[model samples]
Target chain A: MPSWPTLRLRRQSAPAAPDKPLATVETQHGQRRLAAVCPRAAAMGLRVDMALAEARAICPELTVVEADPEADRAALAALAAWCERYTPLAAPDPPDGLFLDIAGCAHLFGTEAALAEDLSLRLQRNGLAHRIAVAGTAGAAWALARSATAGAPCTVLPAGAERQALAMLPVALLRLDARMVAGLRRVGLKRIGELARQPRAELSARFGPLPVLRLDQAYGAAEAAIAWPRPPAPWAERLAFAEPIGTPEDLSRALAELARRLCARLEAGQRGGHRFAASFLRVDGQRPAIAIATALPLHDAERIAKLLGEKLDTVAPGFGIDAMVLEAEETAPLRPPQAALADLGKPQDTELAAAIDQLANRLGSARLWRAAPHASHVPERTVRRLPPLAARPAWESDPAVERPIRLLRRPEPIEATALVPDDPPILFRWRGALHRVRAATGPERIAAEWWRRTPQEQRPETDLVRDYYRVEDNNGARFWIFRAGLEGMPRWFLHGLFG
Target chain B: MPAPASLAVLRARLHALQPQAGHGVLPFGDPRVDACLPEGGLALGALHEVGAAGIEAETGAVAAGFIACLLARLPGIKPLFWIAPACDLHAPGLLAYGLDPGRLVLVQTRDDAETLAAMEAVLREGAATAVVAEAGRLGRIASRRLQLACLKRGTTGFVLRRWPHGRTAAVQEATAAVTRWQVAPAPSTAAHREPGPPRWRVELAHARGGIEGAWIMQAGGSSDAAHPLRVVAELADAAPAPAVRPGRAG
Candidate 1:
């Protein structure tokens, strides 16, 4: 089995300038105090929780700044995202640190020692003061990273060597509170080795279960799972600019290149993405992203670029964009088109589908719709609206009934006179004109759904029975008119039109 | 001098050498109506306008039914998209005219411009086989754009002119349609009319390379009952007497 090499960053909150004695202070119990101290401040005989006035008295030139934990957390998350270049599994260990599970990636940099050295060199180039420790378990790594001497800022412990490696580290490095560390020191257990040698049940009964759990975790006896801030997409590509690009054309060019690269990766995996999102990282700390969806899964870079181009105006590249990343938000296994000549006729269909996807991408998807049939006798409830690409409704069960071509939005009232109560209208005045009914069809009775109506709704006005008539006027015009209400005085309303 | 028989045969040969007459035409299944068209039938992959012969609700209803019957008779399985200003299309009514409720996609737009835009998009994408759009006043450029889109993807387009109220004349702005037809409701053929097959006075006002003509036709049950649009009669230039009335024997 392969070993799990866990790496942790210590003193992650330290400022960029290590030469100055910089200390971050926060209000503790309404009193201004030092929350954390840099290495220079610590070397200058100042410690954490020291009062600002006392620290200023100790070092006349001490620089004290208010603690901004939010900024520190943001820095840690950005560092974690940067660490993804080395290993796919990188998590932000908050309040100022990062965790990298670099198991199999060590070989890419020659050796584990070399990988740690490379990471140290890169962090140093970025002017970040950090100590990195690699071990078989995260707890051991965390302990060693925090307790390492200033001369050696990087350490790598071989697998199963966590106990020996951590033996010299102090109990405070075990991530315990100040009170717990003071209690452990008072009990004559100053080093991690002394704590580990104590009787387990006694230690649990005295100092509670946390110290014991920490020791077990350090020695690889317990499990530790790191929660990553943002899970890395399987297929993603990034393009970084030395100088930020401010022009829309340049941004488009950069996005096209990134999309092409991502499409290449997707093609290698024989997969297609149904949805893609492009994020533009601006220099002024704004990250704007645009996402587009396709009806058919696609891996072609040009098609993706086209869709993205349509939405380029929506992406605001304020100040300037420094880096752009394209990620496939949703993907599926692609079934390549068959090479047989018999299937050649389907290219037109494919073209049509692509065109539709483009239009849907440009206009919102909700704007494109299909008609769906409903199983209802009500004239208005017989059809439904669906997306354009939905499957066709079943045709075998469609009843052969005579229906009008165009239906009015609502039944418009008209004056009509019939020779008999049951007979069709002989003359009607609709839209202020009298129409002499030259010929007419019978009254097709359509009853309303009584089961849906309540007892209170069974009023004379809510009478829902309709007798539809297909009538033609003297000037050769047809109408689908209906009569509702009572038989004694039926109210006539025009409902549909037949060309 | 050429002999009469030889001259006739020579003319036929010349006509055959020209571009195939019925290459892009969709037959109406009625020879009498097809005979009036330049291509022997309705031209496919082109725009056609349908409107009421008179400014009345009943005439508009007849025109709508005529388009519905044509839509039901369209070949293949491509879905139909109908764009209108409102949700005014009656699905049940269309079903009675032979258009399946399932095959119809209704897109309700806010205005005439949006309706035209949606129709153009549907035609250009070729996502739908046929598109039927209702508009108030379609300009020449807008109709041309729709026509061009249809020609690009071989889509059939139907533009229904829903005349605005209080206007006695139809909205007749010049358009880019291959055929312009006006259909009015005619009396049923059966005496003591028991709701026999529907009849209409169909007038072909515009056809490329063809003279305008008018005819009276009837829709009856054909082999394909799902789309039973047949032209039953061909009226002369002179008006014919009212053949039958509703409650009286002819």
Candidate 2:
């Protein structure tokens, strides 16, 4: 368990003075109180939830800073992400603590006690005051880490010893609310051992079922689920260095090795990934990550490395990185490999898919698309964008209808005059230029889809009925113009340019 | 001065020195137009530049349509990449030129740099049969890079010059493209004062080993999708001039 607010202040303040005390204050129940205190302040008879005025009176020189729960939570979450270097199963225990499920990962650092010691030392070096307790279950570890009776800063409870170890701690360490703790104390139950001695039925009848459930959880008799910050990747490869490496060449080499290993694993499983993320853990506890996505499922190492190499410059090695982890976040089963025959005239589908991926990863997937025809009479609504490799149906269009090559995103209003109420324009002025219409085509009337209109457009005057015309100017430049509205001062607009 | 056998060897060497000599050609299928080109058609595995004449260069509608027709003539069902700064090409309009919208992969970029980069990448990949890019400017070095990429994979590239903001002096800068053209809308020969098929004044402004000429070209009728563009008449003032061979005075 980490005291987040003061830890954050300590981390922010450079070369913190040892004798000065620090406390973070917040308004609780309409009264300002100390939400968290540093070790010096705690030693000076100050506690969390104590009145701010009372704390100030006792220690007039206390460094009081306003508490920011949001910042503290964010810092805790970052720390949890950094802790992924220890185990992939790390989660932030809100407002203050972190939970690391290092069941099988302890062997990497030698033993559970050794791993706890290493974590505690690193936290201390980073200017954070924390308690590390390793146990058979998450609940037992969380409860033990917050208890003051735990002897050492790094406590490792042996298997099957949670009940004995938690007997003497206060019942509040079981994560009970203040009201429940007060109710339990009113019944002369001040310790977890006293609460656990009572019969389950009696305890449920007296203080509800929470106390019983919590006690069972602490003893490993019931499951305690932890919400992981990120779902563990299905496939991952990690590389740890004995000394920190920061040069670009070293990072690229490490990344290449990791990609090779990961791709081998994927090949063995007959799987390919669409999304891959690589995270670099720095010695200063910063995790810089870069992710790349493919247009199709891919398992080739060279292509993956090339795609990731384009983004390798973005990672900043602040104090030098010590570990790197590459994970495949999204994966799918791939088809079995087939031997190649003689070279055909047509390009392979994989070659096109690879090209699409290269461009999509650099310029974004939305920038690349294939056009698919839509069934609509409205010119703008006649086409939609689809993925580059999507199988599209044949596009069928009327051979007689002439459409402009380039369609403006929006229509520009123009001034035009005609001889009749519903005829093509004889003259028009567009973009500050006047043009005499040399020849004109019919008024292809197009009405707005009544079913697509909203209630606000239900008025009669708001109707959008357009009479489209393909007209040519004296200079031989053709334009697609439309006359909008059925009555009263019709308006002309230039919508497209003919080739 | 030389033996007959040595003359044959020298002729083979001359052919080898010609750019994209054996890569093949895509003819306009009109003798009037093809006669002006040294290879009787547009050279494959090379870069070509197309721009609209005068102020019409801003929209580049005519140049786009011309490139679409060229792409439709490319001899395979391989994919085609059309890279542009904006998504403005109307799919149905491309169908009018016999180019299928289904075979085109449209890539929209933020600026000219990205558009050129995508074009080079696609050309280098060698998978696509052709690549058409709509860009505002192409310097000498960029065009050379695109030409080299096309040469590597036997892919043809077309650069349609469009100045969406306004025309600038960059339009006149020299490039390494094999051919450069300028197209302007021309009056259609329709009866009874009605709009007819689209027509353009197509000018072969520059070619490596061909004569300069201009002609009145008209798009094919609605029924003729296979051969969509035909040369109607030649402009007397812009008629075919003498071929300007390399290292030779006019």
TM for every model, in the order presented, reads 0.68, 0.88
lDDT of each: 0.74, 0.85
lDDT of 2 at A260: 99
Candidate 1 lDDT, B1-250, residue by residue in tens: 6699899999999986674433277777665566566667677778898876455332356666778778777765667788876566666666556667677666666677878877887787686778898876778899889877887777889998775566445447778887888777776665565556677878887766554667776665454643366666666772223233222111
**Candidate 2 per-residue lDDT over residues A316-400, each given as its tens digit:** 9988999999999899999775656753554578878877887898899999898998887788998888899898548876777
Tens-digit lDDT string for candidate 2 (B1-250): 5699899999999976775444788988887677767678888888999987555778888898888888888886668999998788898888888888889998988888989998998888786889999988899999999998888788999999888745444438899988899899998876676878889999999886676789988886655544678888888877435544443222
Instruction: Flag regions of model 2 displaced more than 4 Å.
Output: A1-3, A13-18, A27-32, A158-164, A167-172, A177-209, A335-347, A419-422, A455-463, B1-21, B222-226, B239-250
The DockQ of each candidate is: 0.34, 0.62
Report how far off residue A94 is in candidate 1 (Å).
5.3
How do the residues A1-499 of candidate 1 rate in per-residue lDDT, one tens digit apiece?
Answer: 0000001112444433446777778899988898777666778888878898899999988767777777666666776776765676788887766789899889978888899899899877665677888899999988877774525768888899998888988998887999999999999999999999999999999999999988998899988767976576888887878798888799889878988999999999999999999988776546688999988888989889878987899887888887788989999999876677875543345555665676567556765676666777767666677776676564433444566656676778999999988888899998888988877876778877777775755554424888888887766567788899655688898877665
